[model samples]
Target: MKLTLERSALLTGLSHVQSVVERRNTIPILSNVLMGADGGRLTLVATDLDIEVSESVDASVDAPGQVTAPAHTLYDIVRKLPDGAQVQLTINDDDRLDIDAGPAHFTLPLLPSGDFPKMTADGFTHDFTLPASELSRLIDKTRFAISTEETRYYLNGIYLHSKDGLLRAVATDGHRLALAEQTLPAGSDGMPGVIIPRKTIAELRKLIDGTNADVSVAVSESKIRFTTGTVVLTSKLIDGTFPDYERVIPRTNTKELVLDNKVFASAVDRVQTISAEKSRSVKLSLTDSNLALSVNNPESGQAREDLPVNYDDEALEIGFNAKYLLDVAGQIEGQDATFMLESASSPALVTDSDDDQALFVLMPLRV
Candidate 1:
């Protein structure tokens, strides 16, 4: 294959696809990106067995052929080239890929394009389009609660499903849960709940960052695909069933405490400085309109901060992991965050005062 494209265009395409290729792989072809030059565009594809990313960039095509080269190396070379430089790629008869830009030249060993694995993308049961801003809100509000424990693979991703005229995204790591909802997009009716893996969520977030275009999504029992602009990302869905998350969301918590989200997060962060490294626990002693945030660590000293909040119910004291509290607080877009509590032991429900579409639940820890 032979093609000439602007360095900036090539670098953008490479950055979109090359991230899917693992740095080290047992299969040599899996470490390389497949480049196909045809129809006045160069198509780049990279995959790591479970996920595949592809994009097409406008190029001056001199020859129609395909080849594979080290994804990261090619990206680095193009990224380091001078601004506005033209990049030329050619596959030599000796099966090497040559990259030329201005006064700089580099060659990468090639693998047969046929050896590159392409994910089977057929058999999508549902397809829909979501505005970029709404998609970002759903992901940003809940991804923090996604689990890292490998044994519970289902919790490692955000659970997406359509319910009660709303498309909801839910994520939980056993200690806390985050839920965000938006109006269900067209063509999403009767869609089965699917767990989107953490890596795919991260990559999709990068793909949609700063763009205002709508994202086209296709979902099936085993796979999901997201298309935005010229880039297409296909990933395998987590096959395990997500737990019944609705049961854990508290409905009977009557005690209400409203505090400024930023102020509360700052207080929690300060008190956590003296908390034990392992537990990182912070206690909340709530009485009427006064709230006390404290941390007692034997290895270190104790810290206590008082904040005036809107609370009129019976006094309640609860303990939570400082990091978890800050995470939930960070997601709140409003000035005030409302926390509904049933008791010191029951999970606390946190909601953003400005947004009714999102909610959070945090389990208390013994302090």
Candidate 2:
């Protein structure tokens, strides 16, 4: 294929697609990116079997054709080229690609375009649209709780579902759980719930960076796809069923405390410094109007912090992994957070005082 594209345009598209390509591959073609030139535009595609990303950019087409070239090498060459220079790429009869930009030139071996695997758009059962910012917020808040354990394969993804006309994303790693909900869009009714794999969520998050445009989502039993202006990401869905997260959320807590989110988060970080090396546990001693956080380690000294709170319950002491509590606190958006506690052993529910859309549950860690 022969085409002339601006350095900035080509580099942007390459940066997005090359991240999906692996450095080492058993199949040579899988290590390369498929470049198709037609209709005065250049489309780049890369896949690692589980996930695929495609992006198109404007280019001056001299001879419309297609070819596969080393993804990382081509990206590096274009990245090192002079800014604002025009890039010309052409495939010669010797199965090599010649790249010319200003005073620099390079040649790389090419693979047949036919060898690249094609992703099929099939069996999509539901579709929805949402602003990129809101979608990014949902993913960011809950992704930390997604499990990395492979044995429980189903918990390795965020569970997207519709409940009471609300669209929610829930994730849990057995120790901590995050649940974020937003008002469902008009056309999101009857959408089938699916577990979106962690890789797909991460790649989609990168593609939506600094973009305010609307993103279209399509999902089926087997796969899911997210599409924006000129970029599309498709991936295979996890087959196992996610556990019933609703059952774990506490509903009968009798004690409540409201504290500044940032202050509480900082206190947790400080107290955890003296916590046991492996357990990372911190003890919370709550009084009628005071909250004290303390940690003691055999090898290290002890730390304690007291903060005034708005609680009137009887004095209670609870122990939890300070790291898990800090992670949940970071997800709160507003200044104040509400914590509802039923007992020292039961799960505690935490949420922003002004917003009920997002909630977190943390299981107590034995100290």
Candidate 3:
């Protein structure tokens, strides 16, 4: 295979695909990127068995052929080449690749293109389109709550469901849950709920962040595909059922408190400084129009802060992880956040005063 591509264009395409390639792999071919040159363009493809990414860039093709080369090494060589310089790539003796720029040249071993695994586009049931900004917002708000526990494999991905004409993404890690919704596209009906793995979501986020175009999504029982412009990504979905999250959200709670989001978040961050290392719990004492946050640790110290709130409920004191509270507060886009509680032992429902599409449920801790 022989091709000539601009230094910046080649580097940009390599940067995107190299991230999908694992740093270490048992199979040697899995560590190299498959390069295909045809139709005056060069396509770079990489995969790690679970996720696959492909990107194409305009290049001057001297011959139509394909080859596999080390992903990271090729990326590093092109990255150090002089800016705007044209790059020449050639495969000689069917086993080595020669790279040449203005004054620098390098040769590297190549693997047969036939050894690269083929990712088939089969059995995709549903297809839809969503704005890049909207998708990014949904991922940014809920990705923090994704569970990392290996035993609970079902909770490691964000659950995407389409019901009642609204699309929702839900994620949780046993201690806190985040649920966000956006209107479904025109033809997104009958789309099955699927759990997208954490790695896939992260890769999709990076791809979306680089462009403003709309992203097309295709889903099936086994895999999920994302395509935008000249880039495409396919990932294997986690084959497990997500927990029924709706049942966990509290439906009825009489006591309520409304506090400024910024003020509440700042207070919790400060009070947590003295919280115990094992259980980062902070106590919230509520009375008529006043709220107090305090944390006492035997090994460390104690901290207390007061804030004015709009609550007239009976006196209540609750304990919660300071980090969890801060995460929920940061999700509140509005100036004020509303918290409904039944008692110190029950879960708290948090929502913004202006938005009803997103909600957070936080489990309280025993101090």
Candidate 4:
């Protein structure tokens, strides 16, 4: 392929696709990016077998063709080039890829384009459009709770489904759970629940970051595709089934405690300084209208902080992981955070006072 484009345009396209390419590969072709120049555009594609990201940019096509070249090496070269410099790429007779820009030239080994694997997405049962803001909110609120434990592969990503006329995203790691919802878009009725893998969720998140354009999503039993503008991302869905997360959400807890989210998170952070590094436990003692946060570690020291709250329930004391508590608190956009507690052993339900669509549940620790 022979094409000329601005350094910025090429860099943008490379940055989007190169991230999916792994640093080490067993298959030689998998290490290269497929580049095609035709119809006044240059398309870049990179994949790691499970996920693929591609984008097209305007280019001056002198000779229309296709070739495969090292993804990381090509990206680095184009990224360090002077701004506004014109980048020219061509395929040599010896089956090598040539790069030229502003007095610098490099030759990279080329591989056959036919060897690149593409994730086939044939039977998409559901398709929908979601506003960029809503998509971002759904992901940002729940991703932190996604499980990193590979053994429970089903919990390693976000669970997306439609229920009660709301499009919801749920994630959990057994210790903490996060759920966020938005009004169901028009085309998402009767969509089957799907588990989006953690890597795919991260790539989709980065693709939609800082953009106001709507995202076009297509879902199948085994694959999902997302398109925004000229960029398209295709990923294989997790084959394992996600557990029923709704069963874990509290329903009968009536002990209501409302307090400033920032204040509570700060207190947890401060008291946890004297907590054991292994458990990082923080204790919350609640009375009629007061709350006390304390931590004790024989190896370190003891710390406590008192704050005023709006609680009228019977006295209760619970211990929770300080980091998990802070994580849930950070997701609360409202000024006040509401906690529904039943007993010291039962899980505590947390919610944002201003956002009824989001919910959080935290399993208490024995401190």
Best by TM-score: 1
lDDT (Cα) of model 1? 0.95
- Tens-digit lDDT string for candidate 4 (231-335): 999998888888888898999999999999999999899999989988899999999999999998888889999999999999999999999999999999999
Against the true structure, what is each candidate's TM-score? 0.99, 0.97, 0.96, 0.98
Of the two candidates 1 and 4, the one with more favorable TM-score, higher being better, is 1
Model 3 pairs in collision: none
lDDT of 1 at 153: 92
Q: Residue 218 lDDT in model 2?
A: 89
Off by over 4 Å in 1: none
Best by lDDT: 1
How far off is residue 56 in model 4, in Å? 0.6
Residue 358 local lDDT, model 4: 97
After superposing candidate 4 on the true structure, give the runs of residues whose Cα lies further than 4 Å from its correct spot: none
Model 4 / residue 228 / CA error / Å: 0.4
Per-residue error for 60 in candidate 4, Å, reads 0.5
Candidate closer to the true structure by lDDT (higher is better), 2 or 3: 3
Q: Please write out the lDDT profile of model 3 over residues 140-169, one tens digit for every residue.
A: 778889999989999999999897889899
The whole-model lDDT of each prediction reads 0.95, 0.91, 0.92, 0.93
With a 3 Å backbone cut-off (N, CA, C), the pairs that clash in candidate 4 are none
Note the clash tally of each candidate.
0, 0, 0, 0
